[model samples]
Target chain A: MTATLGCVTLSLADRLTDLTLSLHEGEVTAICGPNGAGKSTLLSCLGGLVAADGGLVTLGGRLMRNVPVQERARSIGYLPQSPEIAWDVSVEVLVSLGRLPWGDAGAKIGRDAIEEAIAAMDLGALRNRRVSRLSGGERARALMARVLATCPAWLLADEPLANLDLRHAIALMRRFREQAGKGRGVVLVLHDLATAMNFADRVIVLDRGRLAADGEPAHALRSEVIEQVWGCKAGWLGERGMRALSLG
Target chain B: MNRRLILILVAALVVAVPLSLLAGRVWIDPIAPTTRNAALILFELRLPRAALALVIGAGLGVSGAAMQGYLRNPLADPGLFGIAPGAALGAVLSFWAGYAASVWLLPVFALVGAGGAMALLALIAGREGGVALFTMAGLMIASLAGALTSLAISLSPTPFAMSEIVTWLMGALADRSWREVGIAAPLTLIGVGVLLSAGRGLDALTLGEVAARSLGLEPRRLQARMIVGVGLAVGAAVAVAGVIGFVGLMVPHLVRPLTDRRPSSLMVPSALAGALLLLVADCLCRVLPLSGGELRLGIALSLLGAPFFLKLLLDMRRGLA
Candidate 1:
């Protein structure tokens, strides 16, 4: 099912203007913006983690608020930036928390999903280790596995690549692409423009709490738009197809 | 692994119970009773006291674990939210008001006080309050309650009443009978039951309120349950045992390492460990060669727990450094 936000305005002191967008199934959408652009706020609004001051968010043609929490949880997985792990629980057990929405089904599907997510994140070796003992990057991947284990229709992640090393970051982006290929909508709040350009099918750029640009990565990352919205000068150079943006 | 821990805890409890019963001022030979007085001491005094110690310890332990899990702070205790001090104020008020002679009035008043404190805590903390706010509010309420209690004590009409209040505040399980056990059991059981059932919600909460909400766990509902659970358990425990300190805060820390630090897994073991610790402490109070009367349970716990707390603080400082 597709997720849509219609003229959603979230005001937490600063006003986020009318945000209207439709996120289709089977597409990886990267949200990009400068600091305080309300990118994370918009994602939170769509995910129903925060209430909008005005307007509506709907998933699968149903009002987001009207959807039962358990149903919404099963259908959409949200991984917030810097998710705290209060306890030193084992990785496998922490990941299994994702299956809580499904109570007492045959254990096989839950086990399979947990194993697959762990494998996808290359955390099999650290599966039994305490989450508190893991490095920052390992913990991020472990939490990513927790989100993926839910196997939701829509996956919302905020700054998930913040602590990951280069190899793990690339692996995570590839996994997001695979999730999109499998008909799940993957929306990420990303700061790395190069990764967004390389992996995201569509890009939504927020500037000063408003949607500034929304289109294919090539179009949305246009030099003029980047310069205007991000206050930066951008140019593509080298055979590696690197897009560089320097503050003007 | 959990089963082994549980087994070890249960075994320790089994051993501790009999020892607690037999290890008082007058040694009771349970195998062969030397006199009717010994049996009377065993049945009338030690049995009920040991039972009270067990239940109260379990209550504090489970409540502490639940609070820590809910607040996502290892230092979180049942008393951290002012329930114990609130209950203390209620009992003190009852004494000052000349109702200490009534058997049930004191606990009933204490429960009411605990409920009032919890309501105030919730109101001050608000809908989206974080740990810092809750803890700060709790400290404020506790200080207020403690001040009121001291005022009540100072204004007492009789010096005898003031001493009674002092004794109660020191906290003891002495002279407790089956009646006190009956008063504390059901509420503690129900409170522990409520806290135990919130394991999944607590696990989700480790991900923070927003993520927990996204996972379909209602943070408000979970928090409400925790409040009720802690109120009932701690309030009842204070009613019977008179504000025993540190068991709630210390037991979870002791058991968390063995249980892999999973909040849900910590509850039962914490409960068991709390029971064992209190029973042992009570036994030590009886056996120790104190110059005055038998040492109060609360004092003993603080003496033991203060060192542990200091070490924890130093370790935390080191980690920060």
Candidate 2:
């Protein structure tokens, strides 16, 4: 299914003005921008967690605003930035919450999905451990497993890799790739330009609540565009791929 | 582990009920069937009191657990949110208006008061406010309600009515009969059922509001159920037992480590623990030697619960540090 956003605008003191975008299935799209670039706001609108002031969001010819909330939840899985687990429940129980939208039938279809997410995120060993006791990276992975367990058609995560170490971050990127390979849309708000360049099939760049560039990673991360939007000098480092050198 | 803890609590209740029945100021033999006085004490006085204590305790515990879960704070409780004091003011108003003659009017008025406090709390705190803000709002509402209750007492029509209001505010299960039980039980049960139905939604909330909404659980609906359920249960309990303090606040914390800290998981255990705690406290009220009158149940709970609240505050301060 294709998810399209047309002229979506949200006012948060400052405004995100007339932002338009589309997310295609079987693709890993990275949303990259400087701080306060409205990346998270854009994702929140697409995930239906926040309503836009004026615009339309449609998924497979159905207006997102018109869809039942449960139906929307079944189709879109959202992981907020730095999501908190308020309880000390076991990882397994926490992950089981992803199936909540399915109601009682979740027990029947949820088992395999839970197991798969646990295995995919390499959280099988820590399945029974209290989520509060896990290390930062481990907790991030556990929370990611929770979102993945929903097995939604589209997964939209805001800054999910912020607290991860290098290895876990790469692992998460690979998992996103695998999800895309399985015909799901993977959209992430990322800060690391090198990872976005190396991993994302497409990159959408935003600057100050406006879309600056949208296309393949190479074109979107072009040195001039990066310098213009981010106000920084950037270069293609051979093995490192892309690096921001210095502030303009 | 939860199953085992539940079994142990149930066993303790089994032992406690008999102890409650037999250990009052007037000892009644449980085994002897021929004693007329024993039958009178067991069936008439102790039985209803014990039953009332158990139900009210259970109500407080479950409501406290539900409040904590809904607010996502360990310190959240019916009293903390002003619901208890609001209910107290309602009962006091009923008495001041000379409606206390009807056993039913007391709880009904208290429920309305609790509901009013909840509405006022929501208006002040809003849906998105943090815990500190919510607590501050509750304190303000509680203070307002407390002032109103004092006014009702000072303006009472007769000196005897003023004394009755004072005794009621101190909280006691003394001289309580089946009539009190009849008024409180069904309302408390219904409130408990409403809270229990929101268990899964509460569990989903542990992930925070946005994630919970994404999971197809409406946080607003959950909040409404929590407010209404807590209002009903706590209002009925306070109407019957006067303002018994801290059982709701302390019971959930005591049982939290034993169960999964999942908010939903804490409810049943908290309820059982609450019943046990209040039953024991009521018994202690009877057993403790006092030069003046019998120790009030409210006084006993505050004595125990106040220190715990202080410790909790200290721990929270340390956590913040």
Candidate 3:
């Protein structure tokens, strides 16, 4: 499935004007931008959770606006920048919420899907524990597990790696890669440009709500592109697939 | 739904409702039941009062659970939406207008007030129906209704009318006939149906608004359901039983520990628990020896709820609950 954004413009005072992008299944894409650069906004628009003031978003072929809400939810899984668990439910219970779009959630309908998501997030041991008792990293994984339980065609997450430790972060990146390997689209909003360069198949950089760069990591995030978009002198260090950002 | 809790509450209610009839001021003996007005008291008087208690209590419980879920705040209550206050304001107006002499008009007036409040709340919150804005609108309406009710009370034409208003506002099921039961039951049932329909949406909200919306939980639709459900259920309760307090606010908390802790999971159990609590409390009110008269059900609950609230606060403080 292809999620297409055509000249999508959002007026939030920090305008996202005439931005067009396409995301494909079976690939990992990263959206990188400075704060207030419309990264989350763009992701929300693509997920059909927010309506763009101008232009259109098409999921596969149908306009996202015209897509039924439950169908859209079934097709797209969205994780907010900092998801909150309102109730102190068990991790298993929390993860089962992803199956909500399928209806009969917490029942036997999506049991296998929930198990797969819980396994993918490595939350087997902690399934019975309350979300309120989980640490920040654990909570983040639980939130991720909830989205993954939906088994949507497209997974759009904002700042998904912020609270993870190195091992968990690496593990999660591998998990995301596995999802993409299974012919799913993985779109993440990343503040870590190095991680985007190292892990993402495609990177799109937004500057002041405009598309500053869009392509392979090496080309779109070249030293000059970084300097021009970020307004700072920076250079990429290390070899491909393990790149780091070195500042002057 | 917590099956064990439901069973326990239902069993307890089954026992308590019958015993409540026996324990009232006229203590009817089960064995050798040959009292002059035993049949009249049991069938006509206590039966309807007990039914009203159950209906109103269950309504309050479900409303409280739904409100807490919608706000994602444990402290939210049926009164938060201003429907109860709006109903009170309407009833007070009836008294102030010297229309309290008419039985049907008072309840009709209160129902109209509740509808008006529901409309104003929806209008103020608008289509987005975001939680924060919805809560703020509720507060605005509640405060306005409260001020207006106070004004009506203070400026009541006669001391007799003022006394009647104060006593009624204390909240009770005393002297209520099957008529109150008829008015409250259908409304509460329909209201519960509406709230139960919003269960999935409330469950989705465990992940907060954005993620819930992503899960196909429409905020505006949920808000509309809450407005209508709470308006009807709580409005009917207050219209018949006066401002019976704390059942909606307290029942969910009392039942939450027994359930899965999900908002949807807590709702039915809360309703059962609320019914049980109100029945027992109303029973105690009927039997309690007060020189002035039988203890008012509203005062009885507030007395219980205040301490429960303080304990909840302290438990939260200690992270033990």
Candidate that would win on DockQ: 3
TM-score of chain A of 2: 0.90
**lDDT digits (tens) for residues A1-248 of candidate 2:** 12273221222213466566777878988999999888887788778777655656776667677879888888888899889898778998888888877764246578988898899889989999988679988888888888888888888889888878989888788888998898888889999888898889899898887778999988998898899888878777554443433443
TM-score (C-alpha, index-matched) for candidate 3: 0.97
The regions of model 3 sitting more than 4 angstroms off are A1-14
lDDT of 2: 0.83
Best-to-worst lDDT order: 3, 1, 2
Which candidate, 1 or 3, has the higher TM-score?
3
**DockQ of candidate model 1:** 0.76
B1-321 in candidate 1: lDDT tens per residue? Answer: 888999999999999999888897787777887866887898899999999999999999999999899888877788888989999999888886677468888888888889888898888875865657777888998999999998999998899989988888888999999999999999999999999988888878878877887788876777778878898899999988898988988999889888767688899999899899889999999988788779999989989889988887887688620
Q: Highest lDDT: which candidate? A: 3
lDDT of each: 0.83, 0.83, 0.87
Counted clashes in each candidate structure: 0, 0, 0
Each candidate's fnat, in order?
0.86, 0.79, 0.89
Estimate, for each residue in B1-321, the C-alpha lDDT of model 2 and write its tens digit. 788888899999999998998877777666765556887888788999999999999999999999888878888778877889999999888886677577677777887888899899777776764445667888899999999999989889999999988888888898899988998899899999999989888887899888888887876677667767887889889888899988989999999989868887889888889999999999999988897868999999999989999999998788630
**Residue runs of model 1 more than 4 Å from their true location after superposition:** A1-14, A104-106, A238-242, A246-248
Query: Least accurate stretch of 10 residues (summed lDDT) in model 3 chain A?
Result: A5-14
